[model samples]
Target: MARKVTNTRKWIFTCLAWGVALLIFFPILWTILTSFKTEGDAVATPPKFLFFDWTLANYREVQARSDYFSHFMNSVIIALGSTALGLLVAIPAAWAMAFQPGKQTKNVLMWMLSTKMMPAVGVLIPIYILFQRMGLLDSRTGVLIVLMLMNLPIIIWMLYTYFREIPGEILEASRMDGASLWNEIRYVLTPMAVPGIASTMLLNIILAWNEAFWTLNLTTSRAAPLTTFIASYSSPEGLFYAKLSAASTMAIAPILIMGWFSQKQLVRGLTFGAVK
Candidate 1:
């Protein structure tokens, strides 16, 4: 009787889990469906789910209306550029905090994490003014720097956690072998931490790719990424649901493909230190 009850409970939980997963995925599925519909069918009063005349008109119109390639290139540059910069700065910082702790190290880590809690908009005006004065506004270099700094704390925190899992004795042995600080990190430490670093890179790329507020506020035509590309669809005339959905689909497709492919690496990295 107890074994039967356990089986029943497992089945119930499995169904619940699937239900929640479907609920979360419904919006993306709906968006992809809408992207195939005409503008009228997209925003119909009765909310058309699957019963609509699917058309390629929206995709074609969106392509003709916007330089999709340029926006895609901008997104690739910004996301990759910012993530590369973040890793360079964060790796060493994490190494120090992980291996050579001081009295204030914990305090400093907490302080860094605390910054993430602050509302981004609160500092936007100051950052904008600084950017204007420095000629950073609407420049790829400008947005790259901003995105890198914005995501830096998370990068440091994640790398620090991964580094901590590594035994310090390995670095100590490297030191005994006359491995200079740079060589120790470059050769001994980094290779061991590849999985963690890869995961960190993937996550930071996603964060930078999805960042909308800063991109919208800082960039005009010259430096605008996919976020701005999607935003351009909004107008006082009202939403072009089908076209907007198509643009949205295009903007997100690359990252979605990337995330899907790299999910195993991400999971492996996340679980790097979970076991002994």
Candidate 2:
């Protein structure tokens, strides 16, 4: 009877988990479905789920209206560029904090993490002014620097956690072999942490890719990423629901594909130190 009860409970929980997963996934499913409908069908009084006739008009119309390839390339550049810069700065900072501790290290970490809690709006005016004066407004270089700084703390925190899991004794042995700081890190430490670093880079790229507020406020047509590309569909006239959905789907497809492919690496890196 106990074994039967346990099995029944397990089945119940399994069903509940699947239900929640489906519920969360419903929006993306709806968006993809809506993208295939006519504009009228997309926003009909009585919504059509799957009964309506599907069409490819929206995808073609979206491309006709804007340069999808340009926006896609911009997103790729900004996401990758910012992530690369973040990793370059974070790896060394994390190595130092993990290997060499001071009394204020914990305080400094907390301080950096605390900055994430501050709303971007608080500093918007000043940042905007600085960007304007420096000619950074609406430039890819400007946005890249902003994203890199925005994500730096999180990158450092993740790297620090991964570095902590590494045995310090190995580093000591490297030192005994006359491995300089650069060589020790580049050869001994970095190679061992590739999985963690790759996972961190992938996640950061996703975050930067999806960032809408900064991109919208900072960029116009020239330096705009896909976020701005999708926003262009919204005009004084009204929303083009079908075309908007198509553009949204197109904008998100690359990052979604990347995330899907790197799922294993992300899981492994996140669980790097979980077990002994």
Candidate 3:
């Protein structure tokens, strides 16, 4: 009877979990479905759900309207560039904070985290002016630099957590073997932390890829990413629902595929220190 009750509970929980998952996924599902509908069907008052006349015209029209490849490449470049630059800075900073001792380290970490609590709009004017002066506005380089800076704190925090899980004795053993600091990090620290590092990189790439506000405000035609590509469907007249949905689906597809493939590694890395 106990075993039967446990199984019943498990089934109930499973159904609830599926329910929540579907609820969360409904919007994306709707967007993809809408992408296949004509504009008239897309915004119908009754909101057609699966019974509408589906078509691929929106996708073709979206392609005809803009250079989807250009925005896609821009997103790829900016996301990758920022993640690489952020990792370069974050790894060492996290390493030092994790392995080395300092009186103000905790305070410093709290201060760094505090920056994220503030609204992006608060600093927008200054950053905009700086980018303008530096010739970065509406440029890929400008957006890349901004994303790197924006995600740097999270990157450092993640790496620091990962680095803390690695035993200090391993690093000590490397030093005793006459390994220099660089060699110790390269050989001893990095290999063991691969999962964490990889997950951090992946998460940051997703964050940068989906970042709409900065991408929208900082870029125009030349440097615009997929977020901007989607926004282009909206105009002073009205929203092009079908075309917008098509653009959104295209913009989100790559990152969605990436997250789907990398979820296991991401979950494993995120839970690295939790178990032991």
TM-score, structure 3 vs. true: 0.84
Q: Model 2, range 1-276, lDDT digits (tens) per residue?
A: 999999999999999999999999999989999999998999898899998989999999877777777888889899999999999998888878989978989888889777876888988889999999999999999999999998888788777777787999999999999999999978998898887787789878988999987899999988999988778766825658888888888888788888897776555444433332
Candidate 3 lDDT score relative to the true structure:
0.86
Off by over 4 Å in 3: 40-55, 236-239, 260-276
Q: Which ten residues in a row have the lowest lDDT in candidate 3?
A: 267-276
Per-residue alpha-carbon lDDT of candidate 3 for residues 177-219, written as tens digits (9 for 90 to 100): 9999889878888799887788889988988999988999999
Compute each candidate's TM-score over C-alphas: 0.83, 0.85, 0.84
- Backbone clashes in candidate 3 total 0
Model 1, total clashes = 0
Task: Quantify all predictions' global Cα lDDT against the true fold.
Answer: 0.86, 0.85, 0.86
For model 3, what is the error of residue 246's alpha carbon versus the real structure, in angstroms, after optimal superposition? 1.6
Give the Cα error of residue 198 in candidate 1, in Å: 1.0
Any runs in candidate 1 off by more than 4 Å, and if so which? Answer: 1-4, 44-48, 51-53, 177-183, 236-239, 257-276
Q: Candidate 2, after superposition: displacement of residue 51 in Å?
A: 4.0
